[model samples]
Target: MTKKGGSKHLKRLAAPAFWPILKKEYRWVTKPSPGPHPLGRCIPLLILVRDMLKLAENAREAKRIIFDGEVLVDSKVRRNFKLPVGLMDVVSIPRIDVHVRIIPHTIKYLWYVGVPKEEVNLKLVRIENKSLIKGNRLQLNLHDGRNILISREESQKYKTLDGLLIEIPSQKIVQHIPLEVNKLAIVMDGRNAGRIGRIIEIQEKPGMSRRKFLVTLEEASGHRFQTILEYVMVIGDDKPIIKVSEGT
Candidate 1:
């Protein structure tokens, strides 16, 4: 296929899995259009950026370099997330000593993996091999040499314990906050204080807990802040509802 034709193919494959878009904006890039009409011919751009960052040992440091004006794209300083960058775009980073050429791609999962047929972004955006070794009794491997494992409960569900339909998006439960959106349950010393709050974000701190859920917990009643991951839940809907404390 010609270069132009190849781009069109990549766009079709990547549009649904990565970027949340309904229709292709190929017309937009090839023609004149308005703000954010979706990447016209930059399907490979997504793969390039993702791969570049994935190789980085420290994502925070990488982000700092990207935002600190140390990176250049196509002989120009490019920081904007939305650009018509394609597989041909050249990315230069001074601090990390890396140059990236974007490529088109698809989502990857572990062995015995399958995902929902829907086009929604997979919940687990990233998973490395042997990341969940030793059955459901082990923690999740952060792939960053971190042991940010989920609780046995969360692991069991992710391992198809209750026959929960595991989707890519659902895998992202680890990264996403345990909020009402994902049916996250929070407890303190075996006490339920309502479905605390919505999980908004997760931080994979080095030398800290494997991955920490940064929650916007809604305390129907209880103490503020507690040791996380000792016990938490992001198992999705139909979990045991708990708000009333024991012996209350």
Candidate 2:
């Protein structure tokens, strides 16, 4: 008889290119469990602990560490070894005092950047979409699987693609960064993925669709390029609130 569910295993060769794993060295790889992010855009917790962070010598060791509640994602203990960690998610190993935030990369699709202890509880999430809900509340859907409900009047201040700096665990909004000219933004995808710059101009199309709009960004090196509004994420106003690049 054939199985009705998806396969539990993932082949090494079928893994994403951005994953820092050897395809030929191993035949099978750990498949990320269904989570906030899709398989192609996330790193499995087992792979993260064993391979990327080198915290464990092998899969068995990694599973032991994760099962012991030593690993925390977004300030909460995540016991699942196959938990999917995606962009802007914070991973912490309190036993060793290690903390890292997943961010966009120029070469690799996503990468982890070391963050200070004070920033461990803070996270930035992009507003993917929003809608009206019961009790005159507006629900904001973030890039992650989190949903924030607010008064409809207050929701008017926020727009899609805007970034919200929130305190994890509590999930309190500390600040809102709007996407507009002169704001610091980062390209999440396309040819300019991971490029950080200032938005110089916003070219809006005649239609009402915001996705068709174009944003021109000027890098610090004086290079400028145009990308779709969908690919741009506003990170800050004058400067980034957290460490985004390495060696900063």
Write the residue-wise lDDT of candidate 2 on 1-248 in tens digits: 97888989899999999999989997998899998999888999998999889999999999999999999999999999999999889999999999999988999878999999999999989999998987989999999899998897897799998999999988899999988899999888788989999999999878657966988999988999999988888889778988777844
TM-scores for candidates 1 onward, in order:
0.24, 0.95
Q: After superposition, how far is residue 10 of candidate 1 from its true place, in Å?
A: 19
- Expressed as tens digits, the lDDT of each residue in 112-184 for candidate 1 is 1111223122222112222445655555442112234565665533431111212231333323322233354
Report RMSD (Å) for each prediction in the order shown.
Answer: 18.0, 1.4
- Candidate maximizing lDDT: 2
TM-score of 2: 0.95
Number of the top-ranking candidate, with TM-score as the measure: 2
Q: Name the regions of candidate 2 deviating beyond 4 angstroms.
A: 1-5
Model 2 Cα shift for residue 17 (angstroms): 0.5
TM-score of 1: 0.24
